[model samples]
Target chain A: MAGGFAESGADLELVGISKRFPGFTAIEELDLTIPAGSFFALLGPSGCGKTTTLRLIAGLEEPTTGRIYLGGKDVTDTKTYRRPVNTVFQSYALFPHMSVIDNVAFGLRRRGIREARALAHEALKLVELDHVAARRPAQLSGGQQQRVALARAVVNRPALLLLDEPLGALDLKLRRQMQIELKVIQGDVGLTFLHVTHDQEEAMTMADTVAVMNKGRIEQMGAPEELYELPKTVFVANFLGQSNLFTGPVVSSGKDSIVVDIGGRKLEVPRERAQRHAGEVTIGVRPEKLQLHGAEPKAAAGTNVLGPGRVTDVSFSGVSTQYQIAIPGLGTVSLFAQNRDVGAVLREGAEVWVSWDVAHGFGVADDPADGPRFDPDDDTRSIAVQRREKLEAELEGA
Target chain B: MAFGAFGGSPATTPASDAAPRRGGLIALFLLLPGAAYLSLFFLVPLVSLILTSFQAVDPNAFEIGKFVYAFQWQNYVDVVTTYWPHILRSFGYAALATVLALLFSYPLAYVIGVKLRRFPLLQALALTLVIAPFFISFLLRTLAWKQIFSDEGVVVTALQALSLLGPADHLTGTPFSVIFGLTYNFIPFMTLPIYTSLERLDLRYVEAGGDLYASPASTFLRVTLPLSLPGVVSGTLLTFIPASGDYINASRDFLGSTDTAMIGNVIEANFLQLQNYPAAAALSIVLMAVILVLVGAYVRRSGTEDLL
Candidate 1:
């Protein structure tokens, strides 16, 4: 939590931003404040408008509503080149004809930078690309070219550095290496970094603050650990990690929690009033938290109880084994056990006791108030799209 | 030598199956028609002229010693010594015309290609204007130039009115008229190739250059022009070759300035007026040889055979 708060010098705020393209809205009523020198990430799936948010912040696109404040100045209508922000595009977009030194010095050249060679040398040294400064982009590897792009943007010394999936083209090993490099660079420069990525892993690894976007809006925004530990919606939970959901009706509601009867088994979870309903509630549990024993506990357990079940299947991974257990009156539940010792092995068809702590389950007592009200007409949309594609193919053939 | 870890040694094919089977038949089928046409129209006439070069003309104005086989390779030496200045003049005029054509068309083609890319009809119209001169007869166009640069023409009238010249006698039959006609007739050759190349130039390079902080002009000089060198080479070759050999404009349009007579005029005069078949054939051979050398150098420089 040392760098969790905003820094003092590089404050950026997006105030009540809204952007619409004809009839479609790309981003709506978005607001964010990033402290100076903080690494911030916008995380979302494709078409979630995360890239659009980064573009708007870079002044590449204008917001239909609201203002952008850099430090304290409003720059909502400023053109991209006029703003004090530079972007490293996803494709790296390095000029193919120019040498690495020239590419790095290009922004300075525009500003009529005196001693451009020395400044370019310094920027290349920072990116550890000084030795190859005379080489063209086609001669450099993908990782080296990306570093050149970074050096090119940073040499301008813009107030904010924007990254639009700068590592999206790298392979897994290279991407991991670049993630570390980018983090180190951000720390060394002490510049505000606004990065856009769809990778939850990248966001968790690098960002000081993470904002998860969905359907043109921020679904949740917080530190990675906070979002991971307490997701507020099924979309966030499913996107962040794996979860198994159980559907049932609410049996009782308490001051801070609710008990739901899932297939005759009572499970207690945190009471979120927005989702509180008496019937048709769902409970989510992580598979790793469930435990399995050969049989039920010798005595009646405490609030954390054991359920009788038969192990239907066992899967052996390199470091862990998963057991799928079927409990009577309840559906099959999955249990994950790490290889703690030599003898912690479960076989298929073994009768076992599956147990979980009551507090571990996350409850969402279904409220019709919150959205995605399970419509019956979603199938028609896919059917229409398929039909259109078929018609287009036939027209081309004709 | 050490292919142990990566893979086995490369495979070898049997020598028995190496040669192309039934190859000469296919080759002949593809080439015989063209070969027959060249022999009938080109090869036989060339051989007859070479045979005629050794003969002495009789008093009856008929060529004798058709079969005496008195080989006169000195005919080539005499013709070379007599026509060397005309050869140099042709090259000078062609070089000047090519330079003038490039100057006039490069900006026009660049604008049509890069600036008006979104308006395709405008590009086509611009291209049509460059090619419009070719639609008229070469004789007619040369005649038009003759009138335009003549003493009684409008240009002479205008210059006289402006007092830029003393009188109408100063204007006609100058070398300026010949070069102008040459440039006007062949300017389209310079435009189309350069236009096509500039049109196909990748816009991504420009955007990338701009993003790197390069002004538009620097991008053009550093990225666009160097990459369009192939087009320049092809356009120069296309305009220079035909203009060097052109005689219709020189013979019909301008006064017989020794410096203005192109090599094509030499070939045409020997063929039609002097009735010197041997001289005409030898001169035609020399022109073809020069063209082949220039075209070969151009092709080698461009690293492509399709430079034209």
Candidate 2:
């Protein structure tokens, strides 16, 4: 794997890197190797070390331990200006006084590039911003200024391009547009792109390889689809997409699957998924994989396992209908059903059977290292959404 | 009609009726004292000066004029030409003194304003030193300089010991000594304003320039110097205008008849010794006009009238 990645000539290797600021650890034992010409994303919640890892790779901060390698050379102690890397800050950080063309030419000018005016004109044309070449940053819209910053960094053709939440400040529509634009630019330049973001949808769409980080450590790293489908850790499962997790114990083990007795219901899930100590386990299933049927299946069809549940809530999305079902012994489980037409409507408080293919259900091994069991009633809502509400209420109070 | 279309009207309207009542009171409070003071001290003295300039001095040395109708216009012409060299000498000394003061003060001001911005104690020390020259009386300082430059003075004696001085009356009473005195006296005026302007200058521009790959020297020349022009021009004007009218340095350092005799000495001589009030007034008027014209052209050339 390392050899295949290295021959591409722009591999970025971060080894045993740890950064600490006084009492806070920003990055700990971070080891990641990104292939050349790949769009890689460091996806995490806020303050989970995604931005810190980007800064470390850019040589803006020194790691407490280990080394960073760019193009197969150790560049752990290199100065930001001397390194073959550039960052597009979230604020755009365009020089306010200079024309857009000059802003693009700033790094080149520092390197004593002759004919800067002509070269800057070319870079602007690359970003499709040549029309605003003579305008200052303040005169342009937010999107135009962002394009200028992008052009400014790529004009150097550095080995690695670091983007620190570069699209966090833009509106959703603009962000989606810029995402396609960034991918195209990275493909054209053939430089290693390391993007940091807290938006899971953004990471899924833009990144070829998405690394999910939590509390300064990567929980999983793989192709976007691979990570989303077979997320080994509960953190990765909930972070990448919506998951309805059920905790219980393993009633029996099979050749290729395990039957988990969740509350009182038995679930036969993929045995290859995660380790099961033969007692306690949690089963995770994607909401889209779950299905609801009005009639119970025949008990003789042993391969197709089923359980009865009542529809507690029904939410209408534009193209789909989402149902929250409460099992007799199990907690609420969410399922998304395709909305074929207006006639295909499901009412709340209606009895239904919930079932899924064994392949779709993954058995997460119980953590033996855990000190104690978590209360089922513990709040499992996303901390990010809760934080936003808390901040809004505090602002209103103030 | 355009004003009416905009809903504008005068005292017949309620808003207009109340505005003047308050404005009239404010006008009386703000302008009354200043106007009365200018009428008494400024205009009355200026009118009297004009009256005296036209008067003739009798044999008994008392000036007399009947409506100043018997104007001696020749006195004006005589003063202009007779003391022309002395007037030029005063201006030359002043210009040289201002230049020298700028040279001595600019670096000090730049250091205080730009480098020591966080240290208020350093500024306090500089302020104390700036006003230290004023602590000594002007006459006493000039006299002290005279003694120091005398043949038996410490400086000349040291120079003689070093075999750098010629026979007698070589160094003292020269134009150089007069300029030195003036620069020493007016150094503070040149420094404080330049320091103020430089202190208020935002340093972000310099960093921005540097990030654009311009060297530090280029940054200073292109960004720092152009932005600090107002300070330099003001400091130069402050030093130049006052120093030009100052002949005290020249009169005291040069004694009776030296190359350093300036316009102030000429004016003083005409007033006391020759008892020629008209000539003295004509000379004074000419000096004021010259200073005014120079300052006006400078302000125009600098394009900093509003800044002043």
Candidate 3:
């Protein structure tokens, strides 16, 4: 790699950042530190302030109250052009009037760097788009334009690279391909990348650290596996992936585990996995971690079991069969079973028990605001119908 | 009765054939009014003017308006030679006015379109003020300016007080007053198009420029200006084409004197006072041809022909 293409990365720090517009706050008092040469992802739904954070770091937006430090140097008041940062905007924002090569060379030329085009060519080659260097951005496909945008920012060799939902416009297949390419390129260049996206899968597949943002706050931040295996908050648990949650009071606290009374049944949660062990607590287990049995098997030690409930729905995807079991007092729980035993596909209305290892059950403080209300009407509607209605309501509210 | 009616119809008639034929008939019918209006008002007059340009004055006629139908091609040559200075002066003044208007309107448009975008009410008010002048008559506006620059008017007196103009130097009926009137009257024309283009400009491109390490001025030079060239081209065309052939600002009754008489004034004088139909017609044709060539070259040079 060329020396100009692989400048050592600088760490970014945002201290007490708060951004407020006319009526609403975009980002509340938030502090985050991104280590040098780390591929970090800020994962959040829309309106969660992840993009705002990225903009603040890029100097496109100034925090209402905060200091921004890059490599331990305070740059809070620096102009966007003076900051050693570049961003791949969500829309690509490629200059339509300029050719692709010119677009990539723009930052280099602005910095008065010699051999700007040669450097731009090398950057384009890194993205595997050197062949289309002479074409305009409008002439390229969405995936091609995305790479061009990446190359344009990467060529600058800035201390930090901010990607704001950069692959949001690509198709699913193309997005998957670009995710891998982006990781490879990030490794090759070794620049600190702050990727802001709403797609949890994209974040988990690429980022070294994923921060789940909700309502202008970072609910949880950790490695992808750590976050998935054990989320710290209800928002993080629900937003990252599907989590089957059972909320109840902690009936007993022991040295190594805490027993929670969930709807007449008692479940044991590991003490280390539980964020809180007193008052009302919500224990969660991932769908894939839970195993479904046709009948009550022999009680295994270190196992938490639920549901001598009837199966309400069974959906057979290519690789896995997802089953929804409706317990009498508790609501329906989702379970994903890998297609290892094809002949053992359980039918709807079958009485089944869902069980998981006690270590797999994680606990978080019960969030009453987002807790599922058990509606008598919910039993009549299928899970898919309920999901669609919830989606419609959310859309209307948005 | 329904069965008999259906059975009597031709079963082999292709439904697609009748539909397209009917569609074609409807399209032709829809195009009739506009085509007829153009032919009657525009095409007929144009052909007549072209024919008149080649006619000769009849010496044997008793009336002043009488003309002889002949291929008198020398009429074009005669008008060019006799009024070449007036033609040159028209173009020069129009070009100056267009440049001046652009210089003034670009910043105004940018302020209204880009800067005030956050304050939409203010932007709308600014745009309304730009367009509000159209409610008044164009002639009245020029006359208003003529009054403002009169010898005894406030502007001339102020300039005299500042010693910028000599005591005897008047503002009215000079080249300055005439060109100024053209620019002022057509400023809205120049501003509205440029404003529209600037308003539609996606600001992310500008932000990208800043992110790419270009300073504010450099970003404008490298991005904003080039992207808004389409608007500039159209704005200049809108101001230049009419300003070049406009007689009101150059007429003796308005801002001009004999020294500042343009091709439009000459054409008006030839047609109305001198009754020289051929010369007037020839001048009009020449002006149209020149404006067409100028605008074409400009659009081509700006590389915004695709936009047109």
Candidate 4:
């Protein structure tokens, strides 16, 4: 059964693609390429054009401009049916009237393949849903229906399988289970799978390559770990995970590292990790990378330390405890400590020092007008103030 | 009494016992008006009609309404033999009209429901146009069609000029006019239900068909048609049941004459002009039984029993 769908996948290339609807553009002059047999994820929030890109690749929507190539052949003008692509839609969209076996066999029968039912049964077995072969889609649970949807698409053995948030509707546990199952399925079939989702963790966990999309363009794209560790843009840092950012000017540019001055405190970022060398830069450190100490600890030679801040809030989750420390000059910075510490849990109003290795810090070009600035003397301005201001602005505009 | 019988069950759980007994009484009370209305208006008339169908006509009386209560099943036999042609014509015309109406309305419903969905205003306007005919009286609408297809009307004259009709041919008081009237009148019935189903249709299913390597036409046949089968079944039933028993379109004063008379027209003549109540009642019962059987078989074969 696995051998029947073991054909190698085709590489997909989109050149200068732009999709413009009335009054607004869905995607702007985008170029993307997915090497065959790789699981690539397009990760973004809703309305960020990730789904549109998937649709464009699937040939469900024509690009307003630019060409598409599949396996070195231009298929820009090909109809959706003519393209060797299939989609596991966001809603699954199984034919409610069709039995599970028939739903899986639909594509095979359409291509006039002989013995379609036997192949469909094999596909169902691949998804571990063969027991529900004779049941209608409405009769199955949501997770079962989702598996049926996956089986239906994979059975076609299309060159590229487009998954449009295929697990969005499932419960968290089922979604995680399906994510692993999907990766295994992709490996078995050796097909190019383009999974589109808003979930950053899902993308990070399952994709070989993760592309962070914003507005209508790709913010950054690389291997999941590479993109997470070395995000080149502020949006990527903020969207992919929690980041504690500080905007400052580059005071010293050394051959090995760039030192940035933030409200009288100095921090060093590795020269290669710094996107900008001399101009104003926004440096960011992940919360988990930051270590919290009750007292001023001895800092290593290359370690960056910011300190003497009062802990404003402490939340002890089962596996980790998160602390929001408010520095006098800076607004607030969040740090996460794993539950490995056997000492007393840090309480609110406790004085703490935050430190991380200089190598863990990354810097992107600063935009002064984009977000809130931390007032040096006033410690009252926080995320709430920023959010209230944003809401007020939106209300006034509306 | 029904409430007492239900409450007397010994297997009731203590927590649910009182609540269920009260609920049953309330349900019975709520059912009073509709049950009484159906029994008084529908059941009483149905029973009287069946009884009259088996009554013996008075051979000695001069009055027309005089008949003796007896099991004269021959009344059913006489009516069936004398009006079998009319009965067959009624069903045949109804079937053709239903088919024509479906073909005409399916596209209309698709456009209103799916194609124009982005423009809600246009969809609403198109739906209003479909239902606008109901604003006029059914008789008035049939009469309007009769005038449009009359001997001197524009349609007949144009057909004559186009050599589509014989020189001496007339349009009104013909089978074509009657069937045409039936199709036109019940088009809204067919279009509305199909539109409802199509409106609720998730477009992703159609797109999924295309994504699975099915062509545009094939997608429509396999996905769109089967998903909307319930609507089609109901629409056909709505059109056929009434169109088969319609008297206005096939009346002599409307679009039909003696040659195009249906069972409805035959029953009307016996009941009103001829004052042959027993024959009319027997014919009415036959029409009811035949329609019941056909609709039952149709619903069963269509596999939409859940819809009914």
Q: What DockQ does each prediction reach against the true complex? A: 0.14, 0.11, 0.55, 0.50
Top of the candidates by DockQ: 3
Name the TM-score of candidate 2. Answer: 0.63
A best-first ranking of the candidates according to their DockQ comes to 3, 4, 1, 2
| Stretch of 10 with least lDDT, candidate 3 chain B | B5-14
**CAPRI verdict (incorrect, acceptable, medium, high) for model 3:** medium
All candidates in order of lDDT, best leading: 3, 4, 2, 1
Q: What is the lDDT of residue B197 in candidate 3?
A: 92
> Comparing candidate 2 with candidate 4, which one achieves the higher TM-score?
4
Candidate 3: residue A344 lDDT (0-100): 38
Q: Candidate 2: lDDT over CA atoms?
A: 0.77
What does each candidate score in C-alpha RMSD? Answer: 9.9, 9.8, 5.9, 6.8
Over A1-398, each residue of candidate 2 has an lDDT whose tens digit, in order, gives: 11011222278999998999988998889999999889999998888899889878776578999899987888887655567677787777776545788778776776677877787888788889999999878899888888888888777677778888888888779999999999998887788899999888889899999999988999889999988888777777777777767777778887877787777667777778755637777778888887778878655423434467888877665577778888777678888888887844679888888777777876554342331322121122334346657989999989
lDDT of 2 by residue, B156-217 (tens): 88887888876665556778778888898788899988888888877755544443334577
Whole-model Cα lDDT of every candidate shown, in order:
0.75, 0.77, 0.90, 0.89
Instruction: Using lDDT as the measure, name the better of candidate 1 and candidate 2.
Output: 2
Error of 2 at B71 (Å): 14
Local error of candidate 3 at B216, Å? 1.0
